[model samples]
Target chain A: MKRSLPLAIVFIGGVVFFISYFVPHYISEEILQRQIMVEWIKVISLFAFVIGLYSLIHLHVNKIKRKVDNWQYSILTLSGIGVMFIVGILLPEKFNGGIQQGSIYDWIFMNLQVPLQATMFSLLAFYITSAAFRAFKARSVEATCLLLAAVVVMLGRVPLGETIRSITQGFLDFPKWTQWILDVPNTATKRAIMLGVALGMMATSLKIILGIERSWLGGSE
Target chain B: MKKFFLNIVNLDRRWIFLMVAIVVSVPLFIPSNPPIVPARPVQELYDFIDALPEGSTIMVCFDYSPDSLAELNPMGRAICRHAFSKDINVIGMAFAWPSGSGLGQEVVSSAAKEYDKVQGKDWVYFGYKVGFAQMIIGMGKDIVKTVQADYRGESLKNMELFQEVKNYDDVSIVIVLAAGGTVQTYIYFVNTMYNRPVSAGVTAVMAADYYPYLQTGQLIGLLNGMKGAADYEKLINIKGLGTRGIPSQNWAHIMIIILIVVGNIAYLLEKKQTK
Candidate 1:
């Protein structure tokens, strides 16, 4: 019953959505599109987020209880979530209307969350340099060609690239060359890969619809 | 010579990091105006916006979060500035990420203020919706039904900016600034399903991956990363933060190139010695 019910649900739900896309009648348009997919999906997503929150707190709380490695950091995570929740709930109605213009939520988001996220992202620059220095070797013919192409692209995508071209009286316009590289060869390869990915996605979706892909159901069941 | 090559190959990664820091930071302290030449993609974006008739409304979707603000925020600001300057109405919203709405609100509000454009008239921000692809489908059918309120929790039913905008038919164009796969969702649902004109601003890393969309005319134009943002700034004659950051970007790219070249040279020398 456990397996059969989920498979039945998946097949029914997938077929309904798939059919609704093709048939544009009011039943499909209003009921399926507006009422179910838009409204019901959003409500379900909120519940999913609540479940995720509970899962996170439960996992971290257990880790602290067991005094696992780096369990202290879990306290910080819980504290951050708790403090943000408290602040969001305690704000006046005016500030709580939405996390918009003048809200304390916006303040915390801008000052704390934005900077922390940006700093984590900016660390990519340092790592990219180190990785490139260690790994980007012109060891073979293809490797040499890749290295040259990389140099051209790196130079051509910036302001200094144009300056170099003007200094050479437009004879060495890396920017123009860069545009051609991106427009021609890059587009060709990307299109090929995109076709492969699209086919793969179709196959996976069909598998799920047919109940062949039961991995998403989780566990031995 | 062999020993020197070995030493070069084995140098501490910290030294490379320090050098990169110096290269990137030096440009900031000693600022110089670096000439920005608009690439074909950036020029197309500028020309597309410039050609929009007065009073036409466009939808700008902030599909990214704070993690990509450095690359995308400038593009958002430049596009908003251009649209507002051209007297075009903007209906801003976020569909994929939650943080996107907050960031979108900040960008739209600040840009609106700079141009003396009032909210609910010149532009409206419909914060965020939970469903990404479904929201796009709903928006294509009826925006009001999909997004009921603005970022400030005000109803969008009678708003002037959205009075004529019922769906993708009323909106002239849609620009998605994204750091994730949401741009593809926009392409699939909004562009393919409704035949609406779509453009995108994405980080440099993801720019190459979207070239096919641009080539096939699925994406009308693109702003690729901070350099693209800087290009838009130049096109608008603003020389804002994007333009200012170009020198640092240039230096950083040059440093990476130098490292690659030196590293390759060291590898070759070491191979020769080993042989």
Candidate 2:
């Protein structure tokens, strides 16, 4: 009964949304999409987010209790969340408590979070350089072609490509060539991949709707 | 000669890292504007926005977070600056992440301040909300029903902006400045579903993926990374962060190219000796 109930719900919901797409009349437009789908999705997402937060906190608390390896990092994570919650939610608005602009929460986000994330992403430059220098070799024809394309694209995206064009007076146009590569071959490849992905998504969604994919129900009874 | 080639091929990555650091940093101190010719896609975006009527509204979705601030923040600011300078109403929103709301607020509010545009009159920000797909669809049907308030928790019912701009039909174009797949989401749900004109300013890494969409006319125009932002900055005649960051990018590209060439030559030499 438990399993059948959830499967019945999924089937009904999926079929309704599918039919809603075809029928753009008052029932589908007003009730199904505008009222039901939007509110239900928001409510579901809110509950899922609460579950996620609880899971994270519970996992970290367990780690701390068990004195696991790198438990110190869990403490840092919990402290950060705790501090933000306290300052942003628990305190009064006069104390700069809300998660609005000009609050202490905003300051932490802009000053601490922004720079930290940026710094972490910036390290990719160093690693990518090292990787390219060592890994990009022309052992085969395919490797050579890839290497050349990479070089051309890199040059064309930069000011150096324009410099070359000016120096050669439009005789050598790496930027134009780069644009062709992107507009042609890159697009062709991306489109093919996108089509495949879309088809796969459709199949999986159908399977879920038909109750053939019961993984979403968490576990077997 | 073989030993020298071998050493070149096997040089420690730390040395390469150091060289990269040097190349990237040294150009910033030089302070020279390398020639920037705006690409066709970027120019189209500029032209479209330029041709908008003074009171026409454009929705700029900040679909990125702080990690992409260097690339996307400039694009957001530039679009806002361009729109505000032209007396066009700008509606800022985010459907990607909660952090995107903060970024959108920063970009729109700063540019709004510069142009002395009133919040409810000239602009409104319907900040980040959960459930992106449903929210986007709901906004298409009725925006006020989907979003109840502004980012600051102020009621949107009283906002003058909402009186004129209600749904996708009211928006001239939807520009998504993204670091992730939100551009595709917008393209699918908003553009394909509602037939709204859509464009994107994406990171350099993600730019190539969208050229097909550009060809299909699904995207009206595209801003490809810092260069695209730089191009827009040039069009606006305001040398912002994008322009300032270009020389460093130029030097870095040159350095990488040189390394690729040197590495390839050394590799070939080693192959010949082995043969």
Candidate 3:
């Protein structure tokens, strides 16, 4: 009954969802159905966050009780969370919700979180540069072509290429080169990703429709 | 001697981090002149606004936080400035973080004051809601149902600007300014589902992924990164933060390229010696 019930639910939902796309008449009905789904999603997601916070709170509470090393971090986290919640709830709407929470969220967001996130992401710049340098080492014919392509793209995207081509006034436009890279090669790569993404989405949708995959229910048997 | 020499090649990541930090920061102080970028995307976006008829409705969902202020906020300013200048009926709202409600209102209020636009008549900001995907869906069904009040908890139903904007059906165009998944979510929730036209301004890294949607005509316009913001400002002849940001970004990229070239030359030289 457990499996059959889920399978039946899937069968009805899958067919309707699929049919809703092809038939415009059912689009409104489909949209309305999706609205309910979104509400449920928000509710469930908030619950999951609470579940996660339970662990966080438990860890800190236990640490404080046990006098674990560096237990002060827990106090800081809990207190911050408490204050944030209070301020968020206390803030009047005229000030735009959390602005009443004021600079605490702003300061934490700008000075701490923003820089930290940017720092983490800036790691990508270094990593990508390293990867490009290493991978474009080009010890072979194909690799050499790749290296040349990378070089062209790198130069093409900047004004230096234009400076080199200043006499011709044709081959050097960085915008033109950037456009070519983006329009031609980038589109090709993107198309490949798109095709793969589309196929995967369709396959997953089919699985849901046919009752073959039910992972959304968290290890549903 | 080999161990000592090779140690430089196999340097700790902290060393590279320090170098990158200095490289990126150095450019901010002594900006290398990057020729202005007047890209087509920004032109198309400007043209889109320019072409809109008088009193045309422009619905903007501010879906970013202050974290992306450096990248997306400048473009937001340009959008507000341009829209207000053209006498477009601007409807501003937020759906990302709760913090963004203030940011969204700041755009409209500042623009209104600058252009002498009457609030609740020329533009109405529908506040920030935590609904994310749900808000998009709700707005699609009934704009008022999802957004019954302004950023100040005032009723939007009674507002003249919102009087005609009942649902996705009424709004002429949807503009989403986002940092994360909000752009795609908006396209999915509003544009794709309802046949409503949409465009967005997004962070540089996240910008590349939306090309397919652009191709499909699901997204009519895009402003990506600080570069795009600069382009928009250039188009409008404002020349603000976006313009100032470019030289630093360009120089940072140049430094990384120089590093790449050095590393390659070193590797090639080492390979030859070994041979």
Q: Per model, how much of the real contact set is kept? A: 0.84, 0.83, 0.19
Model 3: per-residue lDDT, tens digit, B29-148? Answer: 884666665666667678888898888888887787766767777888898889989998888888787656767777777877899999889888876765577778777767765666
Q: What is the lDDT of residue A155 in candidate 3?
A: 56
TM-score of chain A of 1: 0.93
The runs of at least 3 residues in candidate 2 whose Cα sits more than 4 Å from the true structure, single-residue gaps closed, are: none
| Model 2: DockQ score | 0.84
Q: Calculate DockQ per candidate and list them.
A: 0.81, 0.84, 0.31
Question: Which residue pairs does candidate 1 place in steric collision?
Answer: none
| lDDT tens digits, residue span B154-250, model 1 | 8889888778888999888999999998789889988898998999999999999999999989998899999999999989988766888889999
**lDDT of candidate 2 over A1-221, digit per residue (tens):** 88999999999999999999889799999999988899787888888889999999999999999999999999999999999999889988899988889999989999998999888998999999988888899989988888888888998888889889999998879899898899998899999998999899999999999999999888778
- True-vs-predicted CA distance for residue A176, candidate 3, Å: 1.2
Model 3 chain B poorest 10 in a row by lDDT: B1-10
* Alpha carbon deviation, residue A143, candidate 1 (Å): 1.8
RMSD of 1: 1.5
What's model 1's interface RMSD, roughly to a tenth of an angstrom? 1.1
Model 3 misplaced stretches (Cα beyond 4 Å): A1-10, A20-71, A91-136, A139-168, A219-221, B1-8, B11-15, B30-33, B96-102
lDDT of 3 by residue, A1-221 (tens): 86788788889877876665567564544453445455455566667767888998898999998989999888988986776665455655555435422445444554665576556665676777556544456678877766666666555444455455575767556557666666667667787997898799889989987878877656556
DockQ for model 1 equals: 0.81
